[model samples]
Target: MRAISIPLPGGPEVLTLGEHPDPDPGPGQVLIEVAAAGVNRADVSQRLGHYPSPPGTSPLPGMEVSGTIVALGRGVVGRSIGDRVCALLPSGGYASLVVAEAALLLDVPDSMNLVDAAGLPETLATVWSNVFMLAGLRAGETLLVHGGSSGIGTTAIQLARAHGALVATTAGTDEKLAACERLGAVILINYRTEDFVERLLDATDGRGADVILDAIGGAYLDRNLNALAPRGRLAIIGNQSAARGTVDVRTLMSKWLTIHGSTLRARPSEEKAAIMASVRENVWPFVVAGQVVPVIDQRIPFAEAARAHRRLEASEHIGKLLLIP
Candidate 1:
């Protein structure tokens, strides 16, 4: 099997494509003959030596993949070889073959191809777990997503809108904001030129956002608190910015706000399985009905993984980036 490996933790240049042994499925796992993989910010962090794959997991950089099942390990049931599935992988997705937990596998929708399905697992699981399950987002409420042009943010906006919630998003450019608007974002804030806290509050008539999905952690913490409505939930899924920051204890206590943070890669397999089940039940219908779609910015050959990393690091993309194997 050909795989992308970070021989040394440094930059995109460190990624090397070389021959590696094919991974075999362990108990409760499935081996997938990879067709395509999703590129994520977490992959960037891993390449730069900032994030490390969990102990006992593969050291490769990809987090999600779409492919066909070639074999199932012991204890796996209800799934078989020849099934077309997209799965959330802890690591090793940047290869011609990878092994994933069977429970984390999701059936590809009839309307989507395998390549597009590659982009769905990580972002879909992230948004559904953070925004809907953890924050308890409900209909008629206001949901605010940071980095609206991002794969996760775009997915969040469409899913929240599909659930009948008003969506607000912040981006750095006019073009990015327009993309968000087309995805049903009612309020678009240009973070480079305006204060998102003020714009979000004013858009909701001072009510602020009931649920806020944030990727920029500490850099926006203070402003995020100020922008939250009473009883609001702030779900932090990434720390793209600096991770350390001071919190205003008074505001948190007075407003009764909740700040929750989670990382899907490090979680137990059973938890990811539960989240996938919820996504299939609650979110798959929206995908089938055309209420949600994969927004891809670019597709690169698997051997050119470094170029994909460079594109994502430069922040030039509008949505998910895929690597075709």
Candidate 2:
């Protein structure tokens, strides 16, 4: 099997394709022959030596994969050889073969191609867990998503709107904003030219957003607080701009805002499995109905993994990027 390995992790140049032994399924796990893997900002961070894989997990960068199940490990049930599936992985997805816990697997939708399915697991689980399950977003509420053109952002916009919430999102360019609008975002904030806090408040008649999904961590903390409605929930999943920032205790106390921070890559298997189950039951239907789809910018060959990393780091894409393995 061929896999992309990061020897030292300084830049995309560190990623090199080389022969590696195929992974076998362990107890309660499934062995998949990978067809495609999704490239995420997390991968870039890992390449730059900022985020390391969890202990006892593969050192590879990919976190999600779509493939055919070639074998099932002992104790695995209800899944079999030759089943087409997509799964969330703790690591090691950037290869031709990877092992994933069976409980975290999702059946690939009949309506979607395998390449597109590769883009679902990470974004689906992240958005569903943080935005819906953790924040408890409900119908008739206004939800604001930062980085609306991103993989997580695009998924968040559609899922929030599909569940009956009014969607507002921020993107840097007119093209990205237009893409967000096509995905059911009613309020579009061009962060390069306008203030998202003011735009969100005006769109909601000065009540602010009931739920806010933010990836730009400390840099947006103050504005995010001001953009929230009383009792609103704010979920932070990434710290792309900066890792540390100060929050106003007075504003938080006055509004009674709830804050949540989470990372999916290092969670225990049971929690990830639970998130996958909820996504399958609640979000898969939307994909099957064509209400939500994976918006892919491009697919690069697995051997050219370095280019994929550069594409993600450049922030030139409107959605997910895939690596054909």
Of the candidates shown, which would achieve the greatest lDDT relative to the real structure? 1
Number of the top TM-score candidate: 2
RMSD per candidate (Å) reads: 1.0, 0.9
lDDT of 2 by residue, 105-158 (tens): 999866789878999999999999999999999999999999999999999999
Residue 286, model 1, lDDT = 90
TM-score of 2: 0.98
Model 1: per-residue Cα lDDT over 20-77, one tens digit each: 9988899999999998999999999999898999889999889999999999999999
Off by over 4 Å in 1: none
Off by over 4 Å in 2: none
lDDT of model 1, residue 3: 91
Cα error, candidate 2, residue 227 (Å): 0.3
- Provide the lowest-lDDT 10-residue window in model 2: 107-116
The alpha-carbon deviation from the true structure for residue 147 of candidate 1, after best TM-score superposition, in angstroms, is 0.3
Error of 2 at 225 (Å): 0.3
**TM-score, one value per model:** 0.98, 0.98
